[model samples]
Target: MDIHHLITKLREKGHKITPQRLAICELVLSSKDHPTADQIYKKLKQKFPTISLATVYQTLHLLKDLGLLLELGFPDCSARFDPNISPHIHIICLKCGKIEDYETENLKEQWAKIVKDIGVEPIIQRLDLYIYCDKCKKNQ
Candidate 1:
């Protein structure tokens, strides 16, 4: 989690990076789990008790708009924020509510072909392929 580089990148995008916003960015980038704004607020509270939930939400949205974060879908509820914006799939555990990243490069061509055949330009949206992981299956 290189805060300096992230700040520089945000500055390059003409986004002002305040210290509060930087703290929020640090929390997101350092996190492995795709956390919601509330989750981020809870963690940030430890160090920055005065930081408001609305601020966290605004920062997350801003970062997502800048293409530096991914807004992941939730089948049951609110969206989750992911720092990794790179093209990849995600698997969510139904029981424990765990989120894991799944990387595959083979799907690019297939997706492109599908878009071509459909004759509609499709923006390759964030892939969320839900499946029971090995641990979840074993528990089941």
Candidate 2:
């Protein structure tokens, strides 16, 4: 979602639109590179020096709760946020901590079919493939 639409949604939900909140929204949504909460805090700190990391975490959680984004979290890893909430696999670079989305629209359709065939409902859906991304592979 674009910043305007996200901000409007927040407003409709009675959320206060502070400059900091706006910055966070724009930063997260506009980012193609999935960013961890710490990464966001550091980038934002460059401009909003007083902004707390807790605030970034809270905003990220709020976005996730509202289905505006998806969180890619793993044991012993900082959670990375992806605004492209469509069905896809996250290719994580183990060495550099980079994340790239691998679109799987057809996979979603096939998955739905399989679920229906089995007569089961899914409670959660996420796909992540951890690997040394090309650059990391080259380094290795």
Candidate 3:
């Protein structure tokens, strides 16, 4: 995502664009792997010595509330943030903690059906599949 576009959107939402928030946005935009709040804080701390963990959490929540991020939740792990806001499937490796994003027409249809059955419009829909990665399966 373009930094300028993000700034413009934030401004349009009545949010003040601060350096810390901008840095967080950049990190999320550039990240290929979904990162947890602690991971984001650690990366930001290298350049911003005084950046607090609380600030990172708050910024993440703010971004999520603004529909700029997707929060991935797992039963046994911390929630990770994804910058890709589009409808997609998350294939997660249960053993190695690897997460991969994929898109399938079949799943999209199924999701649509489920949503229709529920009779409510959702802001976002999440679909996750958990399995061991190839390496982990081979190791076992």
Candidate 4:
């Protein structure tokens, strides 16, 4: 996503476009991995020495509330942020803690069928799968 798009979104939502918030959004957008707040803070701190972890958390939560990001939670792990807000699946490596996003037409079809059969409009949905990564499997 373009930085300009995010800036426009903040403007539309009547949010102040602070430099720190912009940096957080840019980091999330550019990151390939779903990053936790600490990871984001660590990266941003290198450039923004005064950035606080609390500020990062607040910004992330605000972005999520605005429907611009997805927050992923795992047992025994800090919640991670995803810039792709659309529905998708997450595959997590149980050993190395690696996470990747997956998509399939079958899942979408099944989701539609389930929602239709239940006769209830859904607000949100998520699917997560955990497995050992290739390197972990090889080691095992």
Maximum-lDDT candidate: 3
Arranged by TM-score, best first? 4, 2, 3, 1
List per-prediction Cα lDDT, in the order shown: 0.79, 0.84, 0.87, 0.86
Model 3 — which ten-residue stretch has the worst lDDT?
Answer: 103-112
Top TM-score prediction, candidate number: 4
Choose 2 or 3, whichever is better by TM-score. Answer: 2
126, model 1: CA deviation in Å? 2.5
TM-score of each: 0.77, 0.87, 0.85, 0.88
Q: Which ranges of candidate 4 are over 4 A from the true structure? A: none
lDDT of 2 at 23: 92
Give a tens-digit lDDT track for model 4, residues 69-94.
88887778679898877667889998
lDDT of 3 by residue, 27-119 (tens): 987786898899999999989999999989888888888788998887876799998887788889989888889987786788788889999
Q: After superposition on all CA atoms, how large is the RMSD of candidate 1?
A: 2.8
TM-score of 2: 0.87
Cα deviation in Å at residue 76, candidate 3?
2.4
Residue pairs in steric clash, candidate 1? none
RMSD (CA, Å), each prediction: 2.8, 1.9, 2.1, 1.7
- The candidate, 1 or 3, that scores higher on lDDT is 3
